[model samples]
Every structure is written in structure tokens, then in C-alpha cells.
Target: MSKSEYNTEDFVLDPEFRKWVLTNDPEAKRYWEEFLSTNKSKIQEVEKARKILIHLSQERFALPDSEIDLQWNMINDKIDHMEGLKRQTKVVSLDSWSAIQHHKEQSRQKRKRNFIRTAVFAFSALGCFIFAVWFQSQKFDDTQEVELSYETMEVPAGVKSNYLLPDGTEVTLNSQSKITFEKNFSGDIREIELVGEGFFDVAEDSLRPFIVKTQQVSTQALGTAFNIKAYPEEPISVSLIRGSVLVTNSEVSDFKEKLVPGEEMFATLDNSTWIKGQFDLKQALAWMNKTLIFDKTPFITTVHSLEKWFGVTFTFENDIPKNLFVTGEFKDESLKNILDGMSYSSRFSYTIDGKKVNLKFKP
Candidate 1:
């Protein structure tokens, strides 16, 4: 292993560092960059926090209430005090476990006493547990539901998956993208979130339109076929094939536009800028054809896509050069081969491990 495996302990016990990571504030970016260059002391803590941050940063697509409930139950079981103890033992100090256990004991005794007044007290406690579970199940049923959905889907490179939505929309997801949506998919407006890229053949539902929400803007359609390429690191773009669509950023009232077939819209997380232009649907949605496209994309931008699309990581010895850009494409390219092709142009240099591909200034 490399000498600098990145100690996790320093990030854990160091309040100055922990506070920097706990929030989504962009103000913390500088600190995170600095920490990356610093010593790696707290291995477990940093790893744990890193994972939590990854998960939280990830997009959550809409799931049916039933599916969501099932997922919540599984998560709830693991997140209750018991699972917390296990995670703390592995990632942080867990002396608080005793306090938790003590409280649990007290609660148990109180519940035990309360049951005594009733005949068949053991049966009463069992009934209460069952009732509590059923009530929770029913409680979720009362929640709202939407219609059509668009979600950012993520898959590792060399793998492909297909998704069928409630509205009869079919999405064939590519590696490392995600889709998020509301359950009913109908409301004051229809909405779905997307990251990476996906080929969407949306089913028509006139009552509630279909919408795709990306880091930058939203795409609304009645029943259309289109593809969206929206990476937070890069501006969002949409290419429609079959039907017309509207792209708008109600989030930034100033930014709004309508799109028709063969047209595309581009926007970003920065400054709510929105742009519209024509697109070659064939070239734009090529990922549906097992192809990866790049056009004057930045070195880091490509790296970020690879990480998500292929589940890889890239480190750098020094800061990436400013204003660097890459123009190329990959079709089922191996990680090493793709990096080599980029470097062939004298633009970037890189090293590869199992999942990490480190790029550095060409020395």
C-alpha cells in the first residue's frame, strides 16, 4: 500500500475537521481539499464518515410507498440503538453503549410494570408490539403519491440495467447514473431527478406530466423518448427523440425554456444558468448504444464520470492543471486503456489500482 493511506483518526477526534464535513456548505470544500493532502491517522473514522457522506450526497429516487416502507423497516431495525452500538465500536468510541443499555433496561422494567395490571400481561406486550408495527405500516399508507417519474440510476461499468416506472415509462440505465422521483409522480407539478445519463421512453399520462429534475434544471414531457446527460460536475443536457419536452428551472424563476424533439437544454448548479440548443439525438444519447462520449470535457470532469459510471477513484499528486480539457470517447474501454488513450494526446497522466486511478501532472 502507499505510504499515505489517509489516516481516519485525525478526522474523527479533530472537531475542527469533523465540523467541516458534517454540512453541505460549499465553504467546507477548501477544508476537505486540504484534509485530502494531510496525514491519514484515523483510518476507521474517516472511512465511516466518508461512506455516510457518499450516501447522503447520493440522489434518492422515488420509490413506491410499500417499497419505501419495507426499506425503512430494514433500515430502522439496523439504525435503532443496537446497530448504532455496532457501528460505533467499529468507527468511533462506544462508551455510550452502557448508558443506552441502562435506558433500555429502565424502559423494559417500566413496560413490564405497566403490563401487570392487565391479565395475560405477556400477551398484552406482544399485542402492543404487533399493533405498533401495524400502525406504522398504516401510517405510511396515508402518505401522498405522484405519477410519472425520472431518476438518476447508477451501475458499475460493464453492467447495464433496465427500470420500469409506474407510468409505463421504461428507462434503460447506463453505468453510474441515478434516477429519483416522487411516488405518485403527479402534483402541483410532475418531477423526477436525474444524474449521469439515461435513455427514457416515457409512458404517456396526460393527467400528470412527466418531469426529469437534474442538478441544473427540470425536463417536462407528456409522453416522449429522450436522453438526459446531467452531471453536477458538468452542466445538464437533454436530447429528445420522439416527443416535445419543456425544460425549466422553477428554482430560478429567471431561467426557463421549452424544448422540442431534436432540441436540447443545458443548465448548471452554478448561478442557475440555462441554455438551449439543437442536438443530434444519435450522438447525444449514444450511451444507450454502449458508447461513452466526451467533447472538450475537463480532466477532472471525466474522472468524476468514470468514478460514478465505473465505480473507480482517481487521486492526484499535485493539483490538476487549470484549463485542461480532453476530447475523446470510450466504448467498453478498460480503465487502463481509456487512461492511456487520454494520455496519448499529452493531456493527462494516470496510474491505476483496483478501484482507484490516480492522475498527475505529466512530469
Candidate 2:
């Protein structure tokens, strides 16, 4: 933080600063926004410098033949302009170097003019080099001023989104889910926090492991493909499709659970604990296929699942039968049809109110 030996170059190359840029940290963005807002006058030249530097950086950077021609033309043009200017102002002896003895034969006046011509380009070069360093600094300062904010986009029903993480992991976020990652995923540990459901196809980086944290549990993997379900009202669940995963709850004494392909572990709420069980991959992941598989699932839990999967709400009034086990599978069924099926079983009757459904016992 000392300014005594403050080298801007060191600041530009600082690993943490670069990492913040890469991650697009909101705090970093806010700091830059506040700093630039306050330091506008002191860094005004940075604006000009950034415009030119950004254009230069965008040019196809390579030792191309066209670039060589461009450089050559610039040098030739500078030499031509100086010689032409000298001709208009004052003529200089071209043979000054040939004969100092011949200088007297020419004139002292022309010798002085010739020296002035030679000094013109030398001063221009020095001036240009000086400006080049200043201009470069301006670009770096502009970068410091630029505010970058990283955000997570929510996925809605009937649509899926695919995105890349900094660590090259591929995430296919399901409807109503989101994933937030640190700007520098390659820090001590590559970690992401997931809300709702997502399918991860993580690229293998052995040196730094990948971790996904939810409300109830944390999943660690070296490289794998898996589905995570962690809706707030629903149980926290993970189903590994391929590779391996280790899940642990920070609160529990024995929290570690190893999951293999086609296996799942669900963490329940409050007094309810984690359930490690074998699951049929197709039945477990039927939602992804736009199918609902309710094999021996309770009517109450089934209603909750329907609410979340379709972004609907359910309510029950009056006394309702406890443990009204509703089981079966349905694909793309209408809400009325689903409710009617449950009512036929004399378990619960329901009526739809906008996106919400009210349930009660038959009178």
C-alpha cells in the first residue's frame, strides 16, 4: 500500500488483481467504479490511452506481411515529411559530411541549417518514445478503472442453458437453477455454489479438485458428470451419472458418502438425515426427460415435487389422510389430469387457482 516505490507495472501484474478481473468479482467492479468516479481528473489521459491501446490490441497480432508494409510506410512517410518541410523553410547542404574544408566553399549559413535538419528527427524519436511509455501506462490505468461484474443467470422451465466455467467445466443448468462461481476458480480449491438443479460435466483437473456446495451438503469431484437437486423446499439430492463423487455435510459427525454411477444421496431437512440409496438412473432423472416418475412416493411429497418441477404452488385445507402413498409415472400430463388421478384414489381432491392448487378431503 506504500506509494514510495510504487511501480504501476507490479500492480498491473499482481496475481490477485488479475484473478479478480478474470472472475469478474462484484467487489472488484464496485471498487473500480468508485475509484474512477472519484479520480476522474487525475486519470483523464487514461481514457484517450485506452481507446488507442484497445484498438491496437484488437489488430490481428502477428508478424504479418501487411504489418511489415505498414511499419515501412510509416518510417518512409516520416523521413519524406521532414525533408519536404526543410525544403520549404530553408535549404541545407547535402555535402556537409563530404567536406568540412568545402563547407567554407559553400557557406556557414547552410551548415547551421543542415545541423538543424538532422536534429529534427532525433528530437521527434525521443518525444515519441517518451509518449509511448505514458500512453502504455494510461492503458493499464484504464483497465484498473473498468468495472466488471459477474452474475449468475436463472434458468426457467421448459428451457435449459449451457455455460462454461473458468476452469473449462461445462454446466447445463436446469430450469430454475443457478450456479455462482468465484472469479478465480483455480485458487486453492475450485468451488461453485449451486441453487436448484444443474448437470455438471466437469473437465478433469487433477491438481485442483472441483467442489459444488449446496445448502445441506458439499460434493467433491476430480472429474465427473452428475445431477444436483437442491431446491429450498425439496430435499438436497445428488445423482452421479458417471465417474465418482464424495458428498459430506459439515454438521454431521459421519457425513461422508461415496457415490458412483447411477447412485444418489439425499439430505433431508432438520431432524431428517441424509439418505444413501441405489436408484434407477432413468427413474431418478426422469424430470430431465420431461417425464415424472413417482414410484411409491407419498402424495404430499409428490405434490411438492409437482410444485417445484412446474413452478406451481399447492395447499391443503381441512383434515387429510396421512401417508396417502401416491405412486406411478406420467409424462407431460396436464394439471387437471394429474389432480383427477389423485382424487380418483380418494386421497385428496384439488382445485387450481392460477399457478396454485388447493387440496382438501372429499366431503
Candidate 3:
């Protein structure tokens, strides 16, 4: 039969479709996804088949060939028996018409009840099958459902990583950052846990809000591009570049802040309080463009930034400067050049040996 003519049972029986749903075969996945996208009418059937396979697989059992054959045979026999009863009607002579009419009425009622019972049996079985399939597909009932498995992606220091999430959201992970999310985003919410920094271009999913949870705060967005800086020991800063987002503190129950484009929310580790204000887009998002900007940033803060950017370790050879600051912008520059520029303003000398750097201040 043509694919257009394929029904739910056909999809469930097809080996390729079963492989895609059960084993997540990549080739099968690609073919079925493309097919379903073009043949929208088959989408529901395919989903039903997928859910059935998942349910059956999780049960650690499959319908035996004999059992399946028996079920089909029983249904066919019941249908044939009903048809035979329909053809069993006969005419009676008028001489005994009263008695004959009464007998015929009783038989008619008996047939009706039997037919109703048979129909109910058939439909009830089908309904239960479909219900089991749908129940297995739902991941929203946390109280009864198994906990979803999550996968974590970590970007090593000195290099950034770009990825497309399961829901088509684009993520740019900065160095020394990690993101953990459900394998397929299978729940009512598409949520992720983030450590360090990353930029998110959220895919628009109105039914399921996208949430990014940090150590002390959580940012929820429906469809927006935002940047988050959540490194350890520093204030968690969420900057909304486009669209709006709701920011909430994890520690405080009544802390909720809404952010618009060009706005940023900051939550310090020290307290449950948070602050929101207008953000400088150019400075806030400079890292995404392979640039770093410092506006009179502290010398030690600059060192920490360099450590993550270049995957290096810095050591102070002498007493650290009590009051020193550096201001500069470096775009895709070498580590040596950045240090050289900062040394002029901060009166510091630095030596780079492999992945370690030594800094000395001139007295």
C-alpha cells in the first residue's frame, strides 16, 4: 500500500518506523521526520505508533504472534456470527400469526442486546490500547512518572561551544561553562541548568516556556535572545537583548522581576535581593563577538577573566596592587597583547610560561 494509505497499525508494524521510535536510529529518524513534515496527515498516526512502541517496550513484553492472530480471528468470527443472525429471519403462516409475532419480537430483542455487547467489547479493547499508548507519551506527571534523564554539555576553558538544543533553541556556551537539559526536552517545560556563562536564542514555544536555572536565580523566556553571566562567586547577570523575560530569585519566594529589551537583572550571591537596570549591549554581549571590554575593571578581575578566556593560571609574584584598574577593549587579540595593553595602565609586568602566567608589580 502507498504511504498515504498507511494507517496506525501499519506504522506500528513497519520495521523502519519501529526502529526510529524504539532505538532512535539516526537514519530512520531523518527519514520519518522528513516524511511526517511533508505528509501532515500521517503525523497523528505516526505519533500514536511511536507511543505504542514506547509503552510496549517499557513493559518488557510484546504481543505474541498467536495472541494477535487469535484476537483478529475472534473479531472476524463475531462479525460473521452477527451477519448470520441477520439472515436468519423467516415468514410464518397467518393461521398462527399471533404466536409467531410474539416469538419474532423476543428474538429481535435478543439479537439487539448481543450486537450491542459485541460492539462494546470491540470498541473497549481499542480504546484501552490507545489509552495506554497516550499515557506512556506523557511526561508531565512528576508525581507518578519516572524522572527524566538529563545530559550535560561542558565547554572547557579557553574555547567556546555552539549547539542547537532539542527544541531548536540556539545556545552559545562560554568557556568553563556547563549546561544540563533533558535528552529530548520531553516534559511540559523545556528547562536547563546552567553554570558559568552562556547566550540563549530561545525558540518560540508558547505551550512550553523555556527556563534557564542558575545557582541563585532562574530566568524564564518564551522567545528571546538573552545573555547570562553566572560564574561562581560573581553576581548572576541576565541581560535581555530582545523580547522579554521573567527573572526570579531561587532563594526568595517573593522575588520576581520582569525584564525588557536592553534591560539586565543582577543577583548577588550574598543576599536574596536582586537589582534590574538598563544594560550596555555592546559591553554585555562583547564576549559573543570574540571581544572583551573593560571599563576601569579591577586588576584582579581582569586576571580572572583572562584565566577563563585563555585557559591559563595566573600567580602574583609579589604583593598584589591595592588600587589598580585597567580599561580596554580587545577583539580576538592574543593573550600577550591583552596583558601588554593592561600593563601600561596598571603598572604591572607579566611573564607567560605555557599555561601559567606570573605577574609582578613595579614599586
**Winning model by TM-score:** 3
Candidate 2, residue 116: Cα displacement in angstroms equals 18
Instruction: Identify the superior model by TM-score, candidate 1 or candidate 3.
Output: 3
lDDT score, residue 15, model 3?
85
TM-scores of the candidates in the order shown: 0.52, 0.57, 0.67
lDDT of 1 by residue, 1-363 (tens): 332443333333344454454442345546554545464454334445443332222423234577546654654454455545754765433478977876786698556544543434345445554454334333322133323334434655646689876445898876766777754332334567777677889876443578887765778898899888775566677787888887777567776667778777766768556567888765686667766788888877777767766677778888877878888878877777877887877456777888877777765
Q: Point out the worst 10-residue segment of candidate 3 by lDDT.
A: 133-142
TM-score of 2: 0.57
Report the Cα lDDT for candidate 1: 0.63
Candidate structures ordered by TM-score, highest first:
3, 2, 1
Q: What would the per-residue lDDT of candidate 2 be over residues 1-363, giving only the tens digit for each residue?
A: 632233443333344434434554556546544655665553333234323333333332334577556655666676667657866986445675656755664586456545654576466554554455445665543335333234465787535678887666888877678887755442446788899888889976544589999976899999999989887767788999999999988778687889999789988857277688877888766876777788778877887777766778878798667767877777888778877877888556678988888888876
Q: What does candidate 3's lDDT look like per residue over 187-279, in tens digits?
A: 568899999999999977554699999986889999999999999998889999999999987678888899999999988898655788999
Q: Which sections of candidate 3 miss by over 4 Å?
A: 1-143
As for candidate 3, its clashing pairs are none
What's the CA RMSD of model 2 in angstroms?
A: 13.7
